[model samples]
Target: MDTETLSDHLVELAYGPKELYVDNTYRRILDSRYTEIVGFDFFCALDDAIETALIDWWLSDDAFWGEVKAFEHWQDEVEDGMAWELMDVWETWYGADGHVKIRKASEREKVSYDKAMKKLLCEHEKKKVSIEAEAVRIGL
Candidate 1:
């Protein structure tokens, strides 16, 4: 497989849902005689090598950990007080028709609502950026 495809597959095997099962499958594939017969030890080694590199990267990347911390902080903020209420309102509006009274809120109420929504959105975006950065740092 091409390097990008191999890397993508390794990332999925390492980080995807049901990771333990995927890992076991990866190991089994590596140990298969068919792999040896086809001279694919190098390909198998790529996965092992990438896993080691990812571990090393994770251990050495302080910036990645900082991003993780920032993400967690925003995540906590998003779950608290006004931010939490704004998120709930957004979810309610998104998933269903918002209540008529809420939809018809007064201008002053709308301003407060808008401000809270904006704050929540900003925090959410910040959290997402950090998460994507972490993913990139891991070559995922």
Candidate 2:
């Protein structure tokens, strides 16, 4: 399928599908690809594109057309790294069932998280630790 068509289907899946269509599509897409480097690269690229689009859509207040333009304001722009960080924060502060009942974190919790992040980041910077190492250290 063309990129636009595939993107549309992905966006539909992202907006809460009736079934696990994305999982089914993932298996099908992987199965259809050839067992070669080029095929592997294509699959990875497509997978990244799908994941990025889904994250963008979920993060946006309105994800029409699967574009990230909604977040590209003059004062703020959600770049890829920032998007990943936001996702990480969401996953950390809010558990898997967070959507069922949205609960704001307490001030103490926020302070604790901020202190932990600051300490971890300082350690990383001081020791020149790789991000992967830091992520491992924090159980990410």
Candidate 3:
């Protein structure tokens, strides 16, 4: 395949939605824990610093914990983890919102890491070019 097509494929794979299970149901959510230092094209289209900041705020331990606490406080049975129906009806409560928040935060976080990712992509491209040049020089 051509270089650009390969790059696009790699980026799509890297930034694609992930499958996650909550309450025995599968959902597609973007990964948000840490930046994977790949796919600069996706990052270049975003505002990295601001995106990162928002992701940090939304996905922070305190923020998540606070949401959980809110749910628990709002519903006493949450402590026992007995009532998952409340989460299924997230529009009426905090459960689905929590998941959606995390997904958005993860997407923003990926954008935030774009600058560094661009550099990594550049270095990788440089190596690929260098190797190609060496092979050409040797009449490969």
Candidate 4:
């Protein structure tokens, strides 16, 4: 395979999403967390920091495999400890929309370090911060 195709395959295996229109906030969190955990540098698309994070994780050192394993362990603990409470949080905060709920719930599940979440990011301190930023930039 060509270099570009090989690169695509590697990225898909490590961080392919079923859809692209995910909440950008969740993308930022996932991308940033993987960068802090994976311990390596990889080429991310220009300004596509989230894609960069995924590529970095996919191409990182052997420690990255261990990091993924740790995430799995964390996910299990979260589900086992607070299944219903989390589900209710989803229903209330997200809404009844199926797609929104699924993506939000996925975000909640994949979140291991809530301390480093988008909620506390240097730039995106609040969801409304991002929402308003988008609104103003795009004049929505």
Candidate with best TM-score:
1
Task: Report the Cα lDDT for candidate 4.
Answer: 0.46
TM per prediction? 0.36, 0.24, 0.24, 0.23
For every model shown, the clashing-pair count is 0, 0, 0, 0
Clashing pairs in 4: none
lDDT of 1 at 16: 38
Ranking by TM-score: 1, 2, 3, 4
lDDT of 1 by residue, 55-134 (tens): 56653477765665666565566446546666586654443444534344667766766776787778777766776675
As a whole number from 0 to 100, the lDDT of residue 8 in candidate 1 is 73
Q: What RMSD, rounded to one decimal, does every model reach?
A: 11.4, 19.5, 28.6, 20.2
RMSD of 2: 19.5
What's the C-alpha lDDT at position 104 in model 3? Answer: 28
**Location of the lowest summed lDDT over 10 successive residues in candidate 2:** 66-75
RMSD of 3: 28.6
How does residue 112 of candidate 3 score in lDDT?
46
**Residue pairs in candidate 1 whose N, alpha carbon or C atoms collide under 3 angstroms:** none
